[model samples]
Target chain A: DVKVTQSSRYLVKRTGEKVFLECVQDMDHENMFWYRQDPGLGLRLIYFSYDVKMKEKGDIPEGYSVSREKKERFSLILESASTNQTSMYLCASSSPPGQGSSYNEQFFGPGTRLTVL
Target chain B: LAKTTQPISMDSYEGQEVNITCSHNNIATNDYITWYQQFPSQGPRFIIQGYKTKVTNEVASLFIPADRKSSTLSLPRVSLSDTAVYYCLASSSGGYQKVTFGTGTKLQVIP
Candidate 1:
């Protein structure tokens, strides 16, 4: 079974402070993604990486950035946190593109709820 | 990415089959249909998907007919634990594809 794990399950930080959320997948998947879930709005993609050191912006990537220094780990960074940024952050991973069914199925971590005060 | 539309919520009883439908009117030819189930306070999990016709897995079934204007997810003998938000995802194939999740159908299974 593939497992995607997040570093923090819950976090609280003051405004203007920098925050980092990490995700690691054991399956050696090539695709990793970060998303934020808000009420009524549903899950919005923040960033995604198809390979190590390669990243792309999703629909909502203004305040967030991502890093993929390794194949099994992906990291999301908030340069300056704010109150409105308080929401659940989710990390996901999938098999490499061109691999079977990777375009659809992505394994997810439990989620990290970050509250930017 | 095709925009999907689904019911806001649904009600069903135990031992009953629940069919939650999602509509994607402008689905592209190469796009594959996917559904995900998300419990409160957790990340969404993959359920079932299909291009056309019926595709059934142990967790649920996906039925997509010709023309692919819509699809239905059938959950048999739903239990209380089965209650969650089911999201219909459609991703366009060819080139760099982007996936957008719908509002999702909130299925509340009752005993």
Candidate 2:
């Protein structure tokens, strides 16, 4: 089974504080993603990494950065956390497409609800 | 990336079958339709995926026609715990393809 685990289930930070959200996957998937879920707005992609040291910006990437130093780990960094950044953050990993009928099947962690005060 | 559109919300009774349709009129030839279910405070889980025709699993069935313009997710004998938001997105074939998830349909199961 593919297991994706997050570093925290909940977090609180003050404004302008630096925050880090860690994610790890056991299946050695090549693709990792970070997304933020907000009420009414739905889930918006923040960043994604296709391989080690390779990252791409998603729909909403402002004030956020990502690191993929190894295949099993992906980290999301908040440069200056603000109250508006409070939301549920999700981490997911997946194999490249065309692997089988499970093409692009993303395995997700439980998610971390971050609160910025 | 193909933009997907589905109903905002749906309601079903316990033990009844529920079908939610998602439209991807601009779906590309290499794009695959995937469905995900997410509960409150939890991350979205992959429910089912299909390229074309029909695909069925223990949890749900995905039906896609020849044109591949739309797809329907059929949840059989839904229970109270089946209530969640179902998201449908078209993912292209490749490792670097971008996936965009829309707001998705919120299913409410009533006993």
What are the RMSD figures for all models against the true structure?
Answer: 1.5, 1.0
What are the per-residue Cα lDDT tens digits for candidate 2 across B1-111?
Answer: 789999999999999999999999999888889999999888899899898899999999999999999999999999999999999998777555878887899999999
Model 2 chain B lDDT-worst window of ten = B91-100
Compose the digit string of candidate 2's lDDT tens values, residues A44-102.
99999999999999999999999999999999999999999999999999988767457
List TM-score per model, in order. 0.95, 0.97
Q: Local distance difference test, per candidate?
A: 0.88, 0.92
Q: Give the per-residue lDDT digits (tens) of candidate 1, residues B28-81.
A: 998888999999888899987788999999999999989899999999999999
Docking class of 2: medium
lDDT of 2 at A69: 96
> Candidate 1 has what TM-score?
0.95
Candidate 1 falls in which docking quality class? Answer: medium
Q: What is the lDDT of residue B101 in candidate 1?
A: 75
Model 1 achieves a DockQ score of 0.60
